[model samples]
Target: MNFVLKTILEEVRIRVFWILICFSFTWFTCYWFSEEFIFLLAKPFLTLPYLDSSFICTQLTEALSTYVTTSLISCFYFLFPFLSYQIWCFLMPSCYEEQRKKYNKLFYLSGFCFFLFFFVTFIWIVPNVWHFLYKLSTTSTNLLIIKLQPKIFDYIMLTVRILFISSICSQVPVLVICLLESKGVKTFIKNRRFFIVFSLFTAALFTPPDIWCQIVVCLPIYLIIELTIFYALIIQVYKRQLAL
Candidate 1:
């Protein structure tokens, strides 16, 4: 028992040390190319009429804060898979063989879906969202020149928030599968209206205050939920076939 405890402690310490190293590497790497990343994130706004392609920092330290925040997020993004793997390693020793197999697949799948959704949101959805917001900002009284220069902190935070929301939301399917039994999943699938309402509410909670953003984000979330149901059904079928 003492040996087991010692082993666990050693593993935890090693994983923590590696995590710190990876974070340091990622932080410096992101800082090195901060300008390019900032430009890429703000690229969508370039096409907008009343907005400059640059972000403004109202406070002297806001730029530093934004840069550090961006670097930290980038570090987290790189570290998530390693962290998840370490967590899985720590937990898997207690799991049965079948459970371990299922969990391992689910872990990788969750990671894949997370990054996939984040990239899609960051690359495709964000640009369109910015375009819509910029257009909406110019709706009434086009005579006045209203420049839309978002603060650096606000812009970076918004970008990070959207990415984080999308990544976590994408893991919904895997989490549902892992936490619930097949019967529970079937029941969840049957409640379409409830899920739709839940999705909208969740989107509203995560997205900007605008109704349009909520609606737009809600659609994909609902779709992912439905796909999760199908995924659950498929897993059930696969399991039954294996039993035979």
Candidate 2:
């Protein structure tokens, strides 16, 4: 009886120790994630000359908390696919093996492409866009803007929103594949003119109202659309051959 009780107590201690260890690691990771990556990311916005400093919150903690929260979300950004994979693993036994295999790459590529696309948007696209909008919009009449002061929370929120949206938009190929694969949306190969119009419309909708903004956004999408059509056509041909 004494031996059994001692064994049980040891087991509980081991389990608790491991749980605490795992939790400590994750907590430390969240801290480093917020501090290193997020703080660096916020550097550009923090140094921005135009961002008015007048929009001050009475609570000092408000700004710090906002920055921390923004960073925390960003830290978790890369975890989406990991979480998805975990879910996939959980559901794998219940799913048809072949079907699971087929969609596995789709699930993985989505998170990766999001990073790539958003990165492009942020590094190349957004800077140019910010410059253009800042320069062009403030012309003469509606200009002389007395340093527009934005709240720290609002700024962080806005940045996250735009970045996330653009990141998702970067997954145009994945979306195209889904439409072609699942839904019966026919590939728009024949109508180059219609493709042009449709592409422009989408760009205009997503981008700011400026013509330059419209053009810049549309051109890349248009290219992606073309590439998608090419690959889609190849797949269709392959499928048809298989059918015959």
Name the best candidate (by TM-score): 1
lDDT of 2 by residue, 1-244 (tens): 9997897677657655655565456545766666465554444454545644234555869867875676567645655555565556555666787878767877767777877887776676555544554455344565465344446566556566557657646677787777667754463454457768877887777655779767866787778867887898888889899999
State in Å the error of residue 164, model 2: 1.1
Candidates' RMSD to native: 3.2, 8.8
Model 1 — which ten-residue stretch has the worst lDDT?
44-53
All candidates' TM-scores?
Answer: 0.81, 0.60
Candidate 1 Cα errors over 4 Å, as ranges: 47-51, 139-142, 180-183, 189-201, 210-212, 234-244
Candidate 2 residue spans exceeding 4 A from truth: 1-38, 44-61, 136-145, 148-151, 184-230, 238-244
Task: Output the lDDT of residue 101, model 1.
Answer: 90
Clashing pairs in 1: none
